[model samples]
Target: MREDTFCWGIVGTGRIATIFAEDIQQEPGMEVTAVVSRSRDRGHAFAQSQRLRATVTDSINALTSSGNIDAIYIATPHSDHLPATMAALQSEYPVLCEKPMGLNVAQVTALADLAQKRGVFLMEAMWSRFLPAMNAFMTLLRQGAIGEPRALFADFGIDVPLAPDSRLFNPALGGGALLDVGVYTIALAHKALGRPTNVYGRARWTETGVDGHSAYTLAYGSGAVAQLFGALELNTPQQAVLCGTQGRLTLQAPFFRPECVSLTRNNGETNHQYHPVTGNGYGHEAREVADMVRRGRKEHPTMPLAESVAIAATMDELRTQWALQYPDEP
Candidate 1:
């Protein structure tokens, strides 16, 4: 663990991978040193475009065993995260995998256990948890700015075109509205409130048997409930609302990357808070991973391993209720 700069290797060249790679370049103590893609040409092209010296390789074995990369970021499809993380773990490399950590709870538990036993750092890329505004919102909640939170309403849905062959509709790729976007809504609910005691969900499945729309309700022990919805067939407001005894907080578009929030008091007075991010919000998560590695920590304090497991478990339960089984799930 060096104090100066941490070397990173990207495991995929997808859209998310490109965004993260660009964000890494902006950070001071982080650099993307390598990229692994199934196509060597694509890997080389992505690396060159980023202006980084990369060892392009089509083989995961070669990329992991090169002994030149510090941590590997898994940006592959949801179904591929497990295998990719395992490949890196086998080579004694730490991993920061994209969320929903695995296709199911059992797989997530297995991978988390393996990483722990191997004494390697493993983190889920739930970028929302590392954002500045989210941190401030949590702080405000803790300080009783919103009083005792009673309910949370959040929705994240996009107008994804219906294509049976696309990953969004392919059951084999762990495609669905829940795993694709609902994970963020669930995470937000969990962050604001603890794990729910009762969970119920209703979903509309696509022709290929994948969920295109899902609405879930989670009941906590304190009689608080979280209402969340995710859909690929519709364009939702993509907002988040936290209601408490004294006031309510509302976030604008893209609740996951919210830049502004409004708090309404019991007296009907509203106060708006704005946080301007320095670079793309992705850099915050990258800096967090770098700092964690520098401090010799295996998991982030904000996004703990336990939280990842719990979120997976919740998603697993919802999928089971909706009969949404992916090809990767055993």
Candidate 2:
């Protein structure tokens, strides 16, 4: 432990939490000093497996009030994100909650309001926003490397076994293709085009009554458009393309965490750029939270609470169109 270490208290000992613990260790001044899980046994196992000299407890209060932790990372299931994040914010601890933030617009809006009232640092762990390649990609777009953005295309898809009770398919767990992997596409489009003026979408539901596959189009007032897709039962190419008046930029497969991008001009010329990731690419966001907290910043500029709210609202509209509602949503 160094004198300038930034300590984290992680909630949930699941896969995301484990990855975060492992990646944070790669950062010079950051560490996961404590963790809380629904099961104390699991918490202990997570600590030992990660070889972390940290505390393992089942009480979020104890972890938050430990006096040594600088922030809290909530990696619970989608349905549990709101409650877990609320607990951390109520404790006045900065929080980095997992993506989607909550199951619906209302839940996410409430969390944003609370974080504002409490004046604590709160960010959605949209790790892709902090990726080196993503930063470069955004930079090129901003610099007009592709000209005025006219349209964008992105998708995320995976083939997972059907399990009604699993996190990815369970209605009780707030499961669906839209929330599970679709958020990356939505967020990427939001970053590139801001809020859309109109959205049109439809979904294919699973036997469990959740969306197994979804596709949507977002239209902007400036005539910019984004076509996005997400699926749990189909393995669609996980790539993204942004087209403009002068050229187009393509992010390779798995665009969410892509390392390479190519820009193609109308003149039939293309240029490739690569920006390598660090430590599974999770540490970059963790470092951002640490840096923001150390500087007394309330939120990260790239991933602000307002944009999160708007993204949630966009999903809310789509769900409204599909007549989809989670068991936990009011």
Best by TM-score: 2
How big is the positional error of residue 141 in model 2, measured in Å on the Cα after superposition?
A: 0.8
Per-residue alpha-carbon lDDT of model 2 for 159-210, expressed as tens digits? Answer: 9988998889998888999999999999999999999989889899999999
Show the colliding residue pairs in model 1: none
Off by over 4 Å in 1: 1-3
Candidate 2 residue spans exceeding 4 A from truth = none
**Total clashing pairs in model 1:** 0
- Scored by lDDT, model 1 comes in at 0.87
How do the predictions measure up, each by TM-score?
0.96, 0.98
Single out the weakest 10-residue window by summed lDDT for candidate 2.
59-68
C-alpha lDDT of residue 206 in model 1: 89
